[model samples]
Target: MGTCACLRVRGGIRLSRVQHNKGERSTLMKKYLATACALCMGLGVAQASQITVINSEAASFVGVNSNESLGDPSNVVMNWTFTGGFNANNVHISGNLTEVLTGTFASEADIFATLPSGTLDIDQSSTGNYTGTVAVSTDVSIATPVDPAGNVSFEFYESFNDGAGTDQIWDDITIEFQEIGIQNGMVNLGALPSDGSLVTYSGHNVAGGLDFFDFSIGGPGVGAAGSYLNAQTIDPVTGDTIDTEIGLFDSAGVLVAFDDDGQDFALGGLYSMLSFGVDDPLTGSDTTPGADGATLAAGDYTLVVGGYDTNFEDLTIGVSTLADVIAGTSAGDYDLQLSYVPEPASLMLLGFVGMLGLRRRR
Candidate 1:
C-alpha cells in the first residue's frame, strides 16, 4: 500500500509540470500573433496621403535702332530675334520707342511731316523659336511750326524736322521690345492617397492664358476606384467661391472625366465635382468606362480648369473671369482648390486593425 501511494504522487508531479509548460507555450503564441498584427497596423499608419503644387514663369526682351528720313515714304522695319526659345503657347509683344529727328528743313511747310506709328508681326517656327519684325511709319501730318530762330528742337515730339531754314530730317530712332510667354503648368504626384485619406492643393491660373496642370500618379495602387477629385475657384481677395469647370486626362492624353456642375446644389447649381473607383455619389449613376467615367490608375494624368463652357481646344488663351468663362471670353485671375480622396479598402483595413487592437486589450 505504501509503494502505490508514492507512485501516484510522482504521477501528479509530472502532470503538473506538463500543464505549466503547455500554458507557457500558449502565452508565447499569443504574443507572437499580437506582435505581427501590431506590425501590420504600424505599416498602415505610416502610409499617409500626399499632395503637390507646381507652376512656371519666364520672360525675355530685345532692342532695335533705325533711321528714317522725314520725307521718306517707306516704313522703318525693326527686326527682333528671340535670344531664347519662346516655348509658351501665347506670346505678348510690346514696345517703347524714342525718336531723335535731326535734319534741317527750309520752311514750316517742310516740318509738317507725318507722326510715327508702329505695328508688330511675329513668326513662330516649328521648333518654338520666334522671329518677328516691327514696322513704324508716320501716317498723319505733324502740325508743329518751325521756331523763329529757324531751329526745331522739340522734346517728346511725335514728329519733328530741322527748322525750315536748314535741310534737317528725322534720324536716330531707338526702340525697346519686351516679350512674355506662358508655358503650361505641371505637377507630379509621386505618392498616391491611401484609404481614408484626403489631399489638397492650391494654385493660380494667371500666367498663361490657358492653364494646364499635369499630374503623374507613380506609386502603387493609386488608381483604384472610389477616389474623388474636386476643383473650384475661391476668391483670392474675398475668399468667396466662384463657378468653374474641371476636366481630367489619362496618360495617353485621353479625356477621362469632366464636370461642369458640382454636387453643391445650394450654390445655385454651379461648381465642379468628380469621382474615381465608384458611381456618382450625388446622381447615383454608374460611371461609364471612358467618357466622364473611369477608375484612376497609377499613371500620368492632367487637370484642366477654366471658366464654364470655355473652349478647351484653344487652351493657349484661356478665359479670364467666371463671367468670361460663362460667356466664353478670356482667361483671368482664379484661385483653385484641388483635392483627392482614398479608397474604401484602405479604410476597411485600418478599421479592422483598430478593432483587433481593442479586442486584444480586452
Candidate 2:
C-alpha cells in the first residue's frame, strides 16, 4: 500500500479539444486521431501500457514480495487463508479489483433501497467458515470468468497476520478465481490470487501519507468515474510497520476514503483497499468505515498512508479530517503499491495512430 503511493504523477494534465465538431466529431474522428497521433509522436509523448493479465495465476505473496524474508519464497506462504477456526478467504477482493480494471462495477445495495438490484443470499456452507456466493458476471457487458454472473462462491475471512513472525504489508491484490462452467449447482473453485506485480518505489508518504496529484477518468472535467486505490502495510522485520491504511482526499482536502485493512480478503485483511467509484458514496457518510469497504469520487485527490495500533473507525464523512485518521496510527514506514488503467483519452489518440498507419500501408 505505501510503496504504490510512492509513485509520482508526471506534472499536470494538458489536453486540447476541438469545439467545432461536438456533434459531428464522429465524422472527423479519423482526421483528428491521425493529426493528434502525429503531434504526439513529434512531441515524444510515449503511450502508457494498459494491463493484460499476464499469468493465469497471480504471483504468490512470495512471487511479488520476495524482498521480505530474504528472498526465501517458502517463508511467505498463502497458509493464512484461514484464521481462528474460520475461513479467512478474501478471494472476493481479488474479484473486485479485476472488475474495476475491466471497467465494471459490482453493487451490493442496502436492503432498504427502493428497488434493490442485488439479492442477500449467502451459501454459508458452514456456520463457522462463513461461506457465500459473490457477484461475478460474464452475463453483463463485461463477462467474468464465471458463466451465469452471480454464481460466485466467496468465503469472507477475518484476515490476520500469517503468524510467521514476519511483519508484512499487502498491496494492490488483483484476485481471480477459476471458472467451473455453469451455475445452478455452485461448486467451490480455487483462487488464482493475482496480486499485481509488487515492485517497490522509493520516496513515498509525506510524514504519514503517500501523496500524489492527477486527473480523473475523462481527464480534466471528469472525476475518477470508476477508480480505486488499495493499500496494505507489510514488512518481514517486526520493527517495520505491519498494519498500514490509506485515505483518499479530493482537491478540497476532505477525507473521501479511508481503509485500515483491505477487504481482509488476503493477509488477514489487515491491509486497506478503498474504491473511488462515482456511484459509491463518501466514507464517514457510510461511516461504517475501515476494511468493511468505503468509496470516494475518483479524481485529482490526495492519498494519506500511515500505520496504526488497532482498527479505528473515526473517519466519518463530515467529521474526520486528514489528521484525525493518521494521528491514531503509530509512526512506521509506509509501503505503497498501486494498480491503474491507462488514460482512455491518451489511448484514443494513440489507438487511432495504429489504425491509420495500417490503412496507409494497405
Candidate 3:
C-alpha cells in the first residue's frame, strides 16, 4: 500500500467547515444543492456494499447486491479474488457448472420450491493468491416467514463437478456485484434526479422477467411528503405497448401497494401510476387500497415492474414469474417514471383562472 496527499473527497462535503457569508444563507440552500447535485453526478449513486467469504458447503461465488433492487434481471459479474496461497506447484485451476439456476427475491429464506443443488467441488494445488469469477444472475430469493429484513436474499452457487480438493487458504476472498456500494439494502438508481424534476428509468428485462428499484419516500430529492410514479411497457420500435404492472413495498419489504390496469392514459390503462398524496384510492394499489396517499413520510420503498400478469406473490405455480416468463407470459422492456405531479392547490388555481376567463368572455 502507498500514501499521498491528494485531493480528498472524504465521504461528502462538510459545509460547516467552509463557511460563507451569513447573508448568503438564503441562497445557499438552492445554490448548495446545485453544487451538491453536480458532485453527486461524479461520485455516483450506487448503494454501499460489502462482501464476505463464506465457508458454506456451497463453495460457489457470493456477491453483494449493492444498488440493485430485487427483481432486476441484469447480469452481474461476480469476481472472486483470494489473498491466501494454496499448497502446491505446477497447479492448474479451472471449473465449470452442470447448469444454471436463477431467482428473484423480496427477502431471505425462500419458501418456494427449488430443485436440489449440490456444492461445487474444487480441488486445486495452486501456487499464489488466486482470483476467479463467474457471470451469474441469481439462484433463488429468500422471502418473509423465512429470513429477517436487511439480510441479503439470494446467492449464486454454481456447482463444480470436477475434483475434490479444498486446500485453498482464503482469508480475504472478495466478490463484487457491479462494483457498486451496498447500503442497508437501499438502491440508488443512477439516473434518479435530485433537482425535483421528472426522471424516467428505462429498463429491459434482458432476461425478460421482472425488474425492481428501491428508493426512499422522504429521502433527498424525493421528499417525505410523498411522491408520484408511473410505469409504461413499451415496444419502442413498434410504438404499440403492452400492459405493465407495478408493486410497492415499504422498508420492511411488505407488499403494501400494487397496481394492475392503472395509470390514466389517452390510449387506455395499460400504464401504471401512483401518487402518494394526490391520486384517489381507486387509482392506486389494487392489492392494498390503503396504499393510496400513504407514501408521505421519511422511509424507504421499493418498486417492482413486471410482466403484465406478474403479481406480488410466491411460486404456488413453480418458480413463479421466472417460469411464467419462460413459458412466455410476462416479460418485456418497460419504463419507470418518478416525479411530483401537480398539487391540488395548483389545480384549483388553474380552475379559478378558467372560470374568470369564461366570465370575461361572456
**CA lDDT of every candidate:** 0.36, 0.31, 0.37
Ranking by lDDT: 3, 1, 2
Off by over 4 Å in 2: 1-239, 263-265, 277-298, 309-319, 323-326, 342-350, 357-362
- How well is each residue in 171-265 modelled by candidate 1, as lDDT tens digits? 33222122223333344332333322222334334322334555444334234555544333434343434455666666666566567665345
lDDT of 2: 0.31
Tens-digit lDDT string for candidate 3 (207-237): 2345556655333322233233333333323
Off by over 4 Å in 3: 1-187, 190-196, 206-208, 219-242, 267-269, 279-291, 313-328, 341-362
Candidate 2, residue 1: how far the Cα is off, in Å: 29
Ordered by TM-score, highest first, the candidates read 1, 3, 2
Task: Find the 10 residues in a row with the least total lDDT in model 3.
Answer: 106-115
TM-score of each: 0.41, 0.32, 0.36
Model 2 Cα lDDT, one tens digit per residue, 81-104: 211221111122232111111211
Instruction: Locate the minimum summed-lDDT window of 10 residues in model 1.
Output: 9-18
